[model samples]
Target: MTQGASGRDGGNSLKARVKTAKSRTLASTLWLQRQLNDPYVARAKREGYRSRAAYKLIEIDERAHLLKPGQKIVDLGAAPGGWSQVAAAKIGADKPKGEAKGKVFAIDLLEMAPMPGVEFRQMDFLDPAAPQLLREWLGGPADVVLSDMAANATGHKKTDQLRIIGLVELAAEFACEILGPGGAFLAKVLQGGTDTALLARLKRDFAQVKHIKPPASRSGSSELYVLATGFRGRREATGEDGAG
Candidate 1:
């Protein structure tokens, strides 16, 4: 078959098409085809990124200016290390003997291969002990917190939305606890809209809250990112409230 521009037919070919095998489900075949044809996937492979998801963060940071040199960062659910890779590079974590030297701490339940300038921990962030452990490892409050975690989808839209919200909420709470004043939090959230209560809490705690759908995000997918900046620090109980 003749191919278009994206194929390897003497430099003028079309996207690669995956042929369905007898044992492969149609859904699986389609997914493979999409992956093979995705330009971002090909670019990621060429650029040595761990996953195509890296471009999402790269684009967001380009517009938002969230990552910076010499900033301490924590990346939750950083398996496959795409976001962690971006964070480390942006903050100059790998730079040796430079003023821009920074640190990146990454944690996830899934084991990830070690990357220079990132300290990886294999543990669930939901563990009660996790926050303190991360703090200890970081040596101080983080200038930024990032989370790209999502629960395995059950194929029910509502259930998936709720699970994603719950994960982001937990990550936000953790950010509030460990973030320094003026810190920023970025997390993956469903596009159906964040829960009202969670939105309210975020607004109360942050100076700015925005939902961004980066271009790298699939157009048909519900994935979005919530960027919350300027943490106000934890609220201290007033006397009357404490008395109660």
Candidate 2:
């Protein structure tokens, strides 16, 4: 990826434009142009982040105050690890041996390069064994679960929205299962916000539930995030288990 100076800086400047290429699809060309002009993309490169998405988590956490030292975190669909990177840094995951700090366990279908403070696992997070494995690695239930996953766009608005909602629902379910009491869940949703049913479920399980659009997120994009904090412990089919 190439970085270009953005008008977002104090200096006045024109947005960079990409010339149409015969070999490139129009969609790809437009995406390239957007990336070129995106201030966060350039900033991410300067700051050594995996992607521009890191700033979204940074902005959200700044207000929500979720990440903390010694907290355990799970990052769903964490390939390329932008959010994971932020979580590790915020939670002091890179502290030296014998110095207590948070742990970050990340999972994705695609392989991620190793990072000092993050443990990356390549597999479907929906696999039956995934929750157990992450808990084992963390040595306990997580303080937070984050999902920045998005389904491949089908170009149909309703269908795409539904797919995004479905992914968030699944992530929320996983978080409930793996999070300790007072845990938090953060995941990507669409512009319409979370589904009514999902929002009700989150409200029941968490003390606070709301949708947020961080400044790092594109203003015109449909992307929104649903945040649920202060988990009330997991509910059970028969009886709820006491979380440590």
Number of the top lDDT candidate? 2
Off by over 4 Å in 2: 1-12, 237-244
> Model 1 residue 173 lDDT?
89
Alpha-carbon TM-score of each model against the true structure: 0.89, 0.92
Worst 10 residues of 2 by lDDT: 1-10
Q: What is the lDDT of residue 20 in candidate 1?
A: 88
What would the per-residue lDDT of candidate 2 be over residues 167-187, giving only the tens digit for each residue? 999999899889988999999
- Going through the candidates in the order shown, the clash numbers are 5, 0
In candidate 1, residue 186 scores what lDDT? 96
Q: Could you tell me the lDDT of residue 21 within candidate 2? A: 94
lDDT of 1 by residue, 1-244 (tens): 1232233534544767888899998888988988887767777777789988898999999899999998999999998999999999999997665554889999888899999899999997778888788778888889999998888888899999999898889999889878887899999999885999889888888889999998888888899999999888766532322111
